[model samples]
Target: MKKIKLGNSGLEVGEISLGCMRISNLHKKDAGYVIENAMESGIDLFDHADIYGGGKSEEVFADAIDMSTSIREKMVLQTKCGIRDGFFDFSKEHILASVDGSLKRLHTDYIDILLLHRPDALVEPAEVAEAFTKLKASGKVRYFGVSNQNPMQIELLKKHLKEDLIVNQMQFSLMHTPMIDAGLNVNMQHDAAVVRDINTIEYARLNDMTVQAWSPFQYGMISGPFVGNEKFPNVNTKLQEIATKKGVTDSAIAIAWILRHPAKIQPIVGTMNPQRLTDIVKASDVELTRQEWYELYLAAGNELP
Candidate 1:
């Protein structure tokens, strides 16, 4: 697996990290098998969130890592907070309390990376800064980032916080690429939907913040799987065509399309099947040429002007 520096934090994480959301529901033996397979495949990063499986995900990870002492130092563990029932919370109390719970659940003294789950409408940057400071001072979290936040929202946090926010996790895939599409057709009024994210891909690179891709195969937000779904016949057809040419799985092509970008986005592969995790990690090795990359963009775009 390829490795990339996560922001300015100096922590190097695998280009493709394992997402642990589904592992909690799997049998304990099954969960252990999945994680162990990921490590053997050269994956050095794992992603988790507080709300995934109602905290069961962390427990499973805690057990899996505990089983292998040597592999623990080779992996990077990341998780999210700030998302509460019916709302978001970034206050000092919530941030502090959430980290404590995460540490306890993961059976670790510190996290490699910590992200704010989502944007809180009533966020107080000062309080968030305080929480980050406390965590850093006490060696609870080494790096910080945010999930599902826009450029302006991150800027707001930077204005009030002293810590370096290293990543912005967002929903991105070949089928749902408004962030990439919007920039390609900027200022084209006839195609109001053309402009999306307004160069968020560029913004992340400019700020030295790594972009983490979530729901990498979904057509939209929790809508449905687009991998082999007949609803997106054209998308799947195109995916297969490219996969055949690359000599890789259709799922690998789906992930490689994101890897082809210059922003260097890290995809969180949310696969619980051990074999599936191994298959997806090979995506890091699949390289798409400029022409092939644009082909995917055009196919995903509603209409090429």
Candidate 2:
């Protein structure tokens, strides 16, 4: 897998990383298979969240792999906080306690990257800054970021945060293109013209922040993956045609479409199936031409004004 510097953090990581949200459902040996396959495919970064499976995913990961200092030194562990049972918490107390829990579960000394899972309407920038400062000073987290946040929200945090937010995790894929849609529509008169994300991709690029695309294969928030779904036949057919021509799986073509963008967005694949992970990793080697990229876009029910 090819490596890219994560935002402005100066940390090099694989273009494709593994998301460990569902690992809690797998057996220890099976979880080992997933982590082993990911490492074999050159995926050095593993993404996690404090609330995923009630924080069991992180525990499963540490259980499946030898997280000794020597082994952990080679891989990057990134996890998110600020999410609770029924509410979001970015308070200094919550942030510190959450990191302690994650460190214990993941069997690690420090998190390679820590992201505020989501925006807390009641968030106090100073409190967040204090949490980050303490975390940095304690050597519990090396870098910081925010997820599902707008440019303005990020700027608000950046104003008080001494450390640069190196990454911004957002959901982007062939099916979910709202982030890209608003930009393409411009002043056109249509539903797509509504800017839902305030040009997040453009904002991240200008500020030197890396946009990490999560859920790269899903059709919608709860519509499940579109790879072979009968309802989205047009996009699936197009994906297959491109995959056949490129000698890779249709999922690989879908992932390649995201990687084709100039912003260098990273696609986090959450598949636990070893075979599927291998198929998705093939995306790193496939480069989609401009025409092919637009073809997949149009096939996915997007219109160009």
The candidate scoring highest on lDDT is 2
Q: lDDT at 300 for candidate 2? A: 95
**True-structure lDDT of candidate 1:** 0.84
lDDT per residue for candidate 1 within 155-255, as digits (tens), equals 98999887899999999988888787667655676653555465677889899999999989888777978888888777788889988987888899999
**C-alpha positional error of residue 284 in candidate 2 after TM-score superposition, expressed in Å:** 0.4
Give stretches of model 2 more than 4 Å off: none
Best by TM-score: 2
**lDDT per residue as tens, model 2, 1-305:** 98888989999999999999999999999999999999999999999999999999999999999678987988999999999989999999999999999999999989999999999999999999999999999999999999999999999998899999999999999999989998999999899999999889999999889999999988788479999989999999999999999999999999999999989998999999999999889999998999999999999999999
Superposing every Cα of model 2 onto the true structure, what RMSD results?
Answer: 0.7
- Shift of residue 151 alpha carbon in model 2, Å: 0.1
Alpha-carbon RMSD, candidate 1: 1.5
